[model samples]
Target: MYIDGKWKAGNSDFAVTNPATGEVIGRVPDANEHDIEAAVAAADIAFADWKKTTAYQRSELLYRAWELMVRQKSQLAELMTREQGKPLKASLNEVQYGADFLLWFAEEAKRMYGQIIPSARENQRFLVHKSPVGVVGAITPWNYPISMITRKLAPALAAGCTVILKPAESTPLCARAMMEIFDEAGFPPGVINLLTVQNPSRVGEVFCTDPRVRKLTFTGSTQVGKELNGLAATNMKRVSMELGGHAPAIVFPDADPVHAAKGLSLVKFLNTGQACISPNRIFVHEDHAEPFIQELTSRASRLKAGNGLENGIGIGPLINELAVGKVDGQVKDAISRGAKVHTGGQRLTEKGLSGGYFYAPTVLSGVTEPMRIYREETFGPIAPVITYRSEKDVIAMANDTEYGLAAYIYSNDIGTAMRAFEALDFGIIGINDINPTSAAAPFGGLKNSGLGREGAQEGIEEYLETKLGGFAI
Candidate 1:
């Protein structure tokens, strides 16, 4: 772990294992409360100087970090694949995605402008300025480790705030690799610090409640995000959370089944469906539901699941046995509730693959609202297609879950797509397009999904505080 501008280890250590092989690949320091305090103190000290640095200087530094990341992309991607169990291609894409944020924010850093406000008094001039929200506590998840960290870190750094990052214990290697890139980019000591620990609750409490941490950014479950939101309230720290999602992809009758099928297949199975934006629920128009299911099932059945680092493999194992068990339990509950298993509903137990936490891409049809797969987030490569007759019914079904992170609609008709987009209750919506959220757009959720945003202009604002200045002209 890197803390206080240097690489240091705590007295205690935690093991980082490969989910595929169950082998301990590396050991991370178990940062205790004292370590957290030191890190926050270091950030507090660094923020004074870092915030004073010109935006151009910060942009240049971030660009340098971006260049370094591109130079080390393969190594970083392999590390991500080894720890997170995402396919090498996906891992490479994650690295590139993460680096894109740095580059994008580098440019955005130069564009952080405050607006002039008209004053009621003739002699008075008013201005609204955006300033750094002091030190930030960034908590990221294990899935898409590199990308998540950059999503928070890039904007926070670009906003001129020092960051104390706490990555998931399951996958700390990617975080460490990023820290190395930052160091190579010559960021000042204490500008960014990383602490790896098994106890997220304790770390979160210390970070969120600390006065030194003026902002809190997290990406994980809704339950945890709520806790952080309450804790951060103690000091009234700015909080930004990108939480869970049970995203829905609605396919209309007039849409291209083949194209929608391919798009849905990728969205449903990306990173073995560990992604928060992964489409878990599918609402298919009754007229085209059967054919869509057939095409989807065929594409899913053809996916090759093996080592992520291996060539030609489409999918990889879950992060651990626990994840596999959670997925299995959900599938079982759905099946018990009268859901039909279309294909690949069992765990993979073949010779070498038996050692790894592998599950075949699953498709569940005949799913109703009461089924576990319908209401809860499966968070696996389990695609559940629910048939609907009318647009109103499908829209209601899509917005049925407590989660409203993202929703997808497939339709050729512009008016139909617009109606679905307006009716669907989600922060991010896609209209006949599989890719909705981008590095240049705001990414977040509604309701229990999460608070705040992660990309584009909104991302930088999450790490900043607005202040009004008034003067007599």
Candidate 2:
């Protein structure tokens, strides 16, 4: 654990394992309530000076950290794959993606501008100043441990706010590695602190109830986000949440079924379908269902699954046994409800994969509203297909869920694409594109999906508070 510019030990320790091989790879501090309090207190004390520093001063430190990340990219990527179970290639890509945030936010720190407003009264002038929101408590999830931390941390630090971070227990090594870089970058004592706890509830409580923490940022499920949002409301602290997503991928009638399927297939199983934006319910036009299903199934069937350390592996093991059970249960429920499996539908316990929690990539057709996968967010490698007759029908089916994080539309027609983009209720929509998020663009959700944005200009605003100053001229 890192606190007040020093390494500290917890009351006890917890072992971190490799999800691929189920081997104990590393151990970290299992922080207690006292540790959580100390982290919060340290951040609170640091904010007094951190918030007063100029944006340029902050930018230089962030730039130094970003440079160090790039210099040690291979080491970071290897650590992520060993602990997080992502393929080495995917981990490498994640390292670059995560590092981009620090670089992007470092420049953004210099652009925190305020404005002068024209007053209705001739004798008065109005000025709006943007200042840091003081201490922030951030809780990040395990799915994308590297990127998730940088996504939240870079913006908070760039906005001149001190932070107390709690990384998910499953992947604390990546977080600790990141802290090492920040420390080497020469951040002041208490400017940033990290707690590697076995459970997050105790730390989350401290973040929500503590009066010193003025903002709370989290990336996790909607159920937990609601709980934290409610807790944060007690102190009226600013909050930012990037919660669960059940994204829909719609293939319009005008699009070629094979091309559309290829596009969706490329991203549907990304990160073994653990991504929040992975397409959950695929809506294909009835006229092109056969070809789309055939192509998608073939692609999903060919994907190689094994330990991520191997060179040519397509996917890796699920986080643990519970994740495998969730995927299997959803598949079985769909199959029982008359859905036909075109490819895999069982756990993989064959040679070389018997030790890990591995599930075969599956594609199920004839999935209806009655199936669990259609409604619930399946954080695994399973794709459920639902046929639609018209644009109106597809839109209705896409928006039927309580989540509105992301949606995708594949259409060659300009009018069709534009109409669907405008009609979708999701915050992030990709028209004929699977990967829609970037460091330069705003990313967030609508409705129950989440609140506030993560990247781009909107991301930094989450850690800032605006003050209006009136002057008599």
Candidate 3:
């Protein structure tokens, strides 16, 4: 753990394993309540000075950190691959994605401007100022470990808030490596702190109940995000949540099924379909469903699953045995409910993959609304296809779920695309674009998916407060 500008160890430690091999890769400190208290205190103390620094100073430090990340990109990518069980190429991409946040926020720090308001009273002038919200408590998940942390931390630091990070227990090594860069970049003591613990509830209680932490940011499931949001409400701490997504991809009759299948296939199994934004339910026009299924099945069957470090490996193991079970259970439930598996559907237990948590990339057709896979967020490489007769029916089906994070539409007609985009309840709508999010865009959900936004100008605003001042001229 890195706290108060120093490296500290707890009395006990927990082992971090490689999901690809089910082997212990390293051990990280398991923090206690005292460690949490110290981290919060350190951040609170540092906030007084850190928040007062000029934006230029903060920008320079962040730029230095980004430069360092680029310098050691290969090393960081290798570590992520070993610990997180992602393909080395994917890990390298994640490193670059994470580093972009720091680089983007570095330039954004100088853009925090407040406007002057005209007063109704003749003798008074009204002024508005944006100030840092003070100490921040951030909790990030295991998927996209490096990028998730940097996404929350970059905006917080850019807004001049000192933060105490609680990274997922399964991926602390990546968090620690990030802290090393921040330390080397000359961030003052307590400006950024990281705590690793087996039980997140304990540290979460401190962040929610403590008076020092002024804001809380989290990237995880909606259930957990709601729990934390409720706890933070007691102290009225500001919050930014990027939660669960059960995205749907709709294929319109105007579009070619083959083209749509290729696009969806590329993004559906990204990170082995572990991402929250991965398209869960695919709706296709009945006229084109057969061709779409055929192409998707062929592509899924061709994917090579193995150790991420190996050459020509496109898929890696699931994060753990539990993840494997969840995906398997979903596929079985869909099959039991009358869904047909067009291609791969079972766990891979071949000679080389016997010890790891691997699941075959699967494609299912005839998926109905009654099945578990249709409603639930299947965080795996299972694409369940449902047929739609008309645009109205498909839109209704897509908007039926509680999640409204992201949705995709494939259509050659601009009118149809515009109508669907405006009618869909989701925050992000991709019309023929599979990869919709970037550091330059606003990313979040509309309803149960999440609260608040990340990236672009809105991201930094989450960590700041608007203050109004009245003065006599």
Per-residue accuracy of model 3 over 194-306 as CA lDDT, tens digit each: 99999999988888889999998988889999999999998898988899999999999999999999999988988899898899999999999999999999999998998
Residue 236 alpha-carbon offset, candidate 2, angstroms: 0.7
RMSD of each: 1.0, 0.8, 0.8
Models 1 onward score TM values of: 0.98, 0.99, 0.99
C-alpha-based local distance difference test score of model 3: 0.93
Itemize residue pairs with steric clashes in candidate 1. none
- What is candidate 1's TM-score against the reference? 0.98
Between which residue pairs do clashes occur in model 3? none
CA lDDT, candidate 3, residue 309:
90
* After superposition, candidate 2 runs with Cα above 4 Å error: none
Q: Find the 10 residues in a row with the least total lDDT in model 1.
A: 430-439
Q: Tens-digit lDDT track for model 2 on 96-180?
A: 9999999999999999999999999999999999999989999998889999999999999999999988999999999999999
lDDT of each: 0.89, 0.93, 0.93
